[model samples]
Target: MNDEIGRRLREAAEAHQPDRDRMLARVHRGMAGTAVPRRSSGIARSWPKVVLAGSAAAGILAVAGLAVAGSVQTTPAHPDSETTLTVPSPSETPATHSPGTTGGTPPPAPGHPNRTTTARPPAGTPTPAAPAGRRVSEGPLSAQGAIDPHSTVYWAQATLTLDVAEPLTAFTVEVRVTQNGGVQSTGQWQTGPAGDFTVTAQESDGAVVYRWELKPGRTVPAARHTFAVQYNHTAGARNADADGYRVQATASDGIHTVQGGFTPAG
Candidate 1:
């Protein structure tokens, strides 16, 4: 029996040898085809993770950018609630004074060492009082006079006698001459002493006018005062065809006034 079994086993082994070699060859070929692409497939599978990491990094960068922008846009808080800064415009700002002294007392001149500075008087201030003298009586002034050298020539002279009831410190005299219904000349004189005289002559309205201011001064007592006046024309004579010339005189002692006049011979 052992002989028979042994022979049978040997025959079977010999018959299956070719099939086994063929099967082994097919398995090796499949394994070679699958092994070549394994590393590349693994790398391809990891690409999603790389992309996700890149997206996450970008998200972090965006969040950081937003935070920086928020910080830049925020306003600084002030410590004091009531305090605020404001800038003044050109029109609203007050003008600065120049680098010099303004109105008040002026500086003394360089050469005037002893000069005194005087303050300006207030508005509507009264004038200073006059010198020491008693108030004179308010009596009318008296005058008696006629122009002298009564000729038909171009020039003439006259004497006037004035009287005042009270003495005066200052006096004023005015003389007016007229001819042919028109004013020919006017003269004014003022003096503080006695024996002050003034003479004025002019031609107007086709006639010559002469005026004189007699002694106007304080030297005249409360009695009579005498003075002379004259008139002349350089270009023309008195109206030979008209009536005599007219003369008018006025005198004032600041408190009293008198007026008189006489025509000279034509």
Candidate 2:
């Protein structure tokens, strides 16, 4: 009876004994069943789960290590900041117009023939009016002076005073200027009531100048001439020349006086 009991005890010990390789083989075989059993509470089934979990953790760590290795290998090869960059050529984004052309016009090639452009003159500009107005002569009436051959201008120097009965606020008077028997008179600016004003003045280039003014404006004119000469010598005039060109323009309550003339003086 003792011998039989010893043999039975040895068989039980061998049957229930745990071994490392055996546990590992069981776990590998357990995967073919493809799912590890969830252990309720004991180390009996937990060893297989432990083996599988260890292997799975090792696989994950290996894959992560490979990814880190690959990143470290590639990151340093390319530059982070480039020193130079290329720009697109002009042909890729051509201009819409030439230097001065409007965008609405056609964009012709550099040497291509383009349509001619024109500009129209501005509107409402007036031409000069013919020179004709009231003329008077108190002394040496109708005396004349010749223009420089370079500048075709004529002047009349005479002294006269007319009685103005109207005492005009503003009115037009006439002066008939005869040069080489060609009668021409420019417009005159009216002087103020009972005040002295200029009849005419010379221009910078030795041209005849016509003067006019309304009352309370100025003793001298302060406006541009709408009537310009055909050939302008718009300077070098004699407005206060006592011997050759002198004018005392006066307008009173009713009468007008113009005192000026060309005397026998070079």
Candidate 3:
């Protein structure tokens, strides 16, 4: 029994010897001031991985927020699919007209004929009347004049006196002589007189005709004969009844005809 007990005790001491040695080595290392390595726990080993995963998630969230903000800034506030925009052409503008004028007619285009515009006359305007013909003389001859007849054995002579207030440029005279209740002769004369007398006798319409014309600046003073004429008989012989001789004379100033007559005593 004692021998067996000793063997068991020895075995137990052998087992405890390794533990003691390990404890002594730790104590020595502490005294020498050397670092001791520690065994890591499961939570400590996985801590770095957890931190990386959380950082990645935060980065993803930040990127997504930046994208959303950019989209909001660029997009239209009131976007609609049916909206439309238009631009005008240069030729579509309107034209302007002048003032104080009715928009009657537009100007003609280039390379085309120009159009004429007529103005309208005012209302209630009257047209002019034509001049009259056959006016009477307003002269001194109309107030005073005479024709006298005289007889010779074979011829008859007559004298004419005309008084005028204005200048005369032309004149005509017609005379008829009668004796013994019968027509003897008729005469007409036309001449240009310049302080002189022109006597002429001819036959027309079965009677004698005479005419005369006065020059420029031929005027009569008040109550004076400025024109005179003496006509000689050239038609034929005179009648025996000298007391029965009569003379009719007509004178004109182109616009009027005046008449006077007288009988002569032998």
The residue-by-residue lDDT of candidate 2 on 1-266, one tens digit each, is 44444455445443443355876777556655634345323345577677777667656655555444444433234567767877889998885433333224221212212211212213442222223332334221222322223322222232222333223344322222222222223222222322443233222122233433334554323221121111221123322232222122333433333333332213
- As a TM-score, model 2 comes out at 0.18
lDDT (0 to 1) per candidate = 0.42, 0.34, 0.37
Backbone clashes, each candidate: 5, 32, 14
Q: Give candidate 1's whole-model lDDT.
A: 0.42
Whichever of 1 and 3 has more TM-score, that candidate is: 1
Candidate 2 weakest ten by summed lDDT: 225-234
Give the candidate order by descending lDDT: 1, 3, 2
TM-scores of all predicted structures: 0.29, 0.18, 0.29
Write model 3 residue lDDT over 1-266, tens digit each, in one string: 44444445445433332234554455555545643333234334544565566556656655555454444433335755685676666577544333333334432212212211112223442221111222223443552223433443223435444445544444434443422322333332212232432334333344333333343345323343322222333233434222111111222444444454433423
User: Of models 1 and 2, which has the larger TM-score?
Assistant: 1
TM-score: model 1 vs. ground truth: 0.29
Candidate 3 local distance difference test against the native: 0.37
Top candidate, metric lDDT: 1
